[model samples]
Target: MSFRAGFEETWRAVLTSRTLVSTMLLAVVLYAFYYPAPYAHETAQRVPVLVVDQEDSGLTREVLRDLAATRGVRIVDTVADMPSATARMRAGEADGIILLSRGVTRSLLTGAPGGGVGVWVKAAYLLRASAIGEGVSAALAGAAEHRLGSAARAFGLRTPVRVIQEPLFNTSAGYKDYVFPAVASVILQQTLLFGVATFFAGRREQGAPPMRRAAFFGAWAAMTLLGVFAGFFYFGFIFWLQDVPRGGNVPALLLTVPLFAAAVAALGLFLGGLFDRSERAMAVLVPTSVPLFFLTGSAWPLDQMPAWLAALAHLVPSTLAVHIFVPLNQMGARLSDVAGMTMLLAGEVLLYGALAGWLLTRRSDTNPR
Candidate 1:
């Protein structure tokens, strides 16, 4: 049979198998439907706080009022000392502890630049600790500035120069924006990895020939591209057609979107060749997908992860693609800066496609039954 005939045969075989058809359609929906991100509440919420009012004065009461009122923070009560606070944290009642030094009030009233204060957080809840410290410091800074008053002017404490910190890529920091596009590739990669297994299994069981592999691959790519565009357009339009302030660059996204689909399809091809049984491939893929998503820096910053794991994590295409698409959408970076990202994505498709193709070429020798 010619390559064209073989491809038609494989495709027909694939379509005739309800499992493949259903899984393919399901893959499209999973890729297209709502992209979920790490919940905000997961990062910080009802953070238990223990305030040590060393001053124990009216001024400290005002400070307590301010900290308690802050969102996502709950001032449980004051501990007798740092030791007590530490014990509570160990007991799971508190997330952080703040120690107000004896001179906290005096330092503000005296118009001093520095105040004596100590803040400690449970080792496990360091993030919540840092946030509590920042909130308390901000409140104190405002109070100290007010007390400095006219003296603050003489000392140039209230300098006109304001250092404004702006987050570029993750402005709204919506779970949808920060996580969706990156994770989309992860889901894509794994599904295709397992999906091609299903595709090839049915073909092999029916004694299909390799002559149509190209046609099957071509059709598969064409269909997959349609799904890719569908996902991008659906989500991109959700922001643009709805006039949301999502801050995505439409043109850049157009260029970057195709790489992910291509790479994912190539992954599917690689997986199809390696597995004799669809069920076995599906089993391996399930365990692999979780770590793959975790490696994309969704839960923790990649920099903070262990050095060895971080080095290995970069090998995944989803890692590179996620890092690229997010910045393109959020930063609207010019072509020159993003050229490297583009290269990484394109490279993945080329390398992985070649690998999968090579594997598939050897399929007949492997004895499918």
Candidate 2:
């Protein structure tokens, strides 16, 4: 069998449509702000910080109170020592740490030097660490001034508590490494979904039948098999060759990419069949993305979103696929953890495929819109 001329023509027709080009332009404009960009909001809120009260002094307690009552800082939990704090931060538990040593208050009161407090943080997060340090230092400075006379507190202020931030996984504070891979997942879902949706919808409108539709779909699967792997392998090879982290298990992720794409393909076919008119379908499809990405934990953390909305997030295939691929691509999560996400894609494929087929039986040329 050779490449179908009709298939090429169908693709050319869809791709060349002036309306589709206009939609693409519109998409780019919308995504300018929708996609990750510069952070203008400097006032940080809910900044996670851990505390180690080794001193167990009144001064330490007062500092904790101020930290809790402060606007920018958020006290997540208390730890025992540097080792404990290091472990928690390593597991993505806390962003910064504050360790108060013994005699810190005594030094401030008597003007006698003592072992100082240590603030440990990931050096990669320099800006955030600095913000945390400033907040903590100001709070502690105020407390010290109240606890001791101005002269005695002045000595302690000159020799302030140390802040140590160790950048563990990513040492360079690269925003690209953190954000691009996740955005890539969004790209994968949108582009391929559009391709898949257009694939079947265009053919069905042209009067393709059981065998022809089957053949075209089979060819599409083959095409997606190549494209999905190409996208995954291309990124993986770049990471290996260019020193970007091959954050996920390369082979495992590569294996899953096609399945994820296939599920998305099925979803598009489902939508395509649901709306026979190409223009109408594209119109409905294009607008749906903004709300979908908003709900998919791309802009907001899943934990921060409302309970119902978070559950609604799981309804879309992109939600699970994004959860599995983005984190794996960025942070190198194991496949065992994302098995549920894969299953979520499978379930949606079944559901939407059934709905698309059912809707077709009821569709008619004169059917009311």
Candidate 3:
């Protein structure tokens, strides 16, 4: 068939195929709203904490007041002992407990490292624990600085230099902003892969004739277009809806999208050739989501992964896609900043596309029906 005719045929097939329609269109629309709902607030706020103040001094009161003033924490109760605070935590009334020892004020007055502030957090959810730890640390740091600055003034000495932190890229440092961009790259690859695999698997099971070179290219082109359409929805609509960071250079995104889509489409076709039935493709590919996502270095650094595993991960286009897309999409990176990953994705497009074509040709030769 001519490329035009084959392209028209493939579009008809995609329209009629339930798997392709659902994965390529329905899933993207539904998840665009659903996935980001949990992180709408960005970070948990005003976590309840109990304070055990054994010092019972003016200085301790001042410190406790400062702790309560922090936006991330709420001092729910001031208890005399650890047992009371433990009971509150057990009762679900508090997320953490802070114990200020008796010698705290005296030690500070003497300019010695005073009795420490003990922070106990519920580790069941690490995010909550982190917020609690950070809030407590900030409060204690403020108190220490106040005391030390006063001592320095009395001694006619200058205050020590303190570091000022300004978080860039992710100004709020929210989990949703940090994670969604990476997952978006994975979603683009997986959905396109699953849809193409299902379509090809069904075709093979029905004993479809081997495709001519033009026809194969036509089908690959149609799938790549669908993948690119999905990418538009992700960056244009979904990212805007969820308020995920987006300052991607238009040319950079336009440059990368087709290469990423084409590579995924070729990979899908290559995998699809191995399946005997429609369902088998899903069975083999669906479980790969978790492993592939982690392998992309979203959950862990590539440098930290075992050498063999890291090398194997780099072979998949999505690994490089995540690295490239996240920076461009979330961090507002230029094309030059991501030149290396762009080259890798372009290479995968060539390699996977050739491999897919070779597999189809080999299959036709073996059967020759």
Candidate 4:
């Protein structure tokens, strides 16, 4: 088949096959809503916390008031002792506990080393626990500062330095903003990968002849186009609707999309050539999604991964694409900033496209259409 004929045939096959349509198109839409549903609130808010105020002093009360007013925490109830606070946490009544020890007020006022505030968080959910810890810590810090400031003023002295914190990129530091952008790239790769693999594998199962160079390129192009569409759907609409942090360099992001899609499509075509049946493609590829996501270094840093594993991760298109897209779309990085990685992605397109073409060409020789 010629390039145009192969392109048209692949498009027709994709549109006609219920399996392909569901895997490629429907799955993208479904995941766009489903994957991010839990993170809809963006950041944890008003996380219930129990306060164990062993010292019911005026200072402790002021700290509790500030803690209750914080966006991340709410003082659901004040308990008499540590045992009661622990019981409430175990019963799921609160996400965290704050203990103002008997001499905490004295410690703060005198700068003594004896008694201090203690925080206990149910670490079952790290993000919730972090929010609770941060909120409680902030309140305690404010109280401590106020006590110290009063003493400083009495002595006619001033604090030499004050630290101001400003979060970068994901300013809210919400789980959705931190995670969804990277996962979106994985979704784009996996969907297109599964779709293309299933499509070509099904053809092989039906005893279809192997595609020539032009035909292979044509089919690859078709899949690449679909992948690009799915990517933009996430980058353009879903981010906006979900209110995930965005506003990166749009033109740079646009330029990166096709390179990412083409590389994934080529990888899919190559993997599809190995499968004799569509079922085999799904069986092998489905389980790989989670592992591939980890390899992207979004949830975990590549530097911390074993050196070999980190190096190997670069072979996956989504890894490179995540690095490229996250910086461009989320961090507003310039094209030149991501130029090296973009070039690497283009290299993947060449490497995988060559392998896929060679494999298909060999198959054509044996099948002898």
lDDT of 2 at 278: 66
lDDT of 3 by residue, 7-82 (tens): 7887899898777889878987877777777877777678899999998877788888887888778999899799
For candidate 1, the per-residue lDDT at 42 reads 29
Each candidate: what lDDT? 0.65, 0.65, 0.84, 0.89
Give each model a TM-score. Answer: 0.77, 0.55, 0.90, 0.93
lDDT of 2 by residue, 221-250 (tens): 553553475456535654454344456667
Clashes of each: 2, 5, 0, 0
Clashing pairs in 4: none
Candidate numbers, best TM-score first, in rank order: 4, 3, 1, 2
Q: In candidate 4, what residue range of length 10 has the lowest lDDT sum?
A: 360-369
Model 4: residues >4 Å from true position, as ranges?
A: 157-162, 363-369
Q: Report the CA-based lDDT of candidate 2 relative to the real structure.
A: 0.65
Quote the lDDT for 327 in model 3: 85
User: What's the lDDT for residue 61 in model 4?
Assistant: 92
Displacement of residue 19 (Cα, Å) in model 3 is 2.7
| Candidate 3 clashing pairs, residues 3+ apart or interchain | none
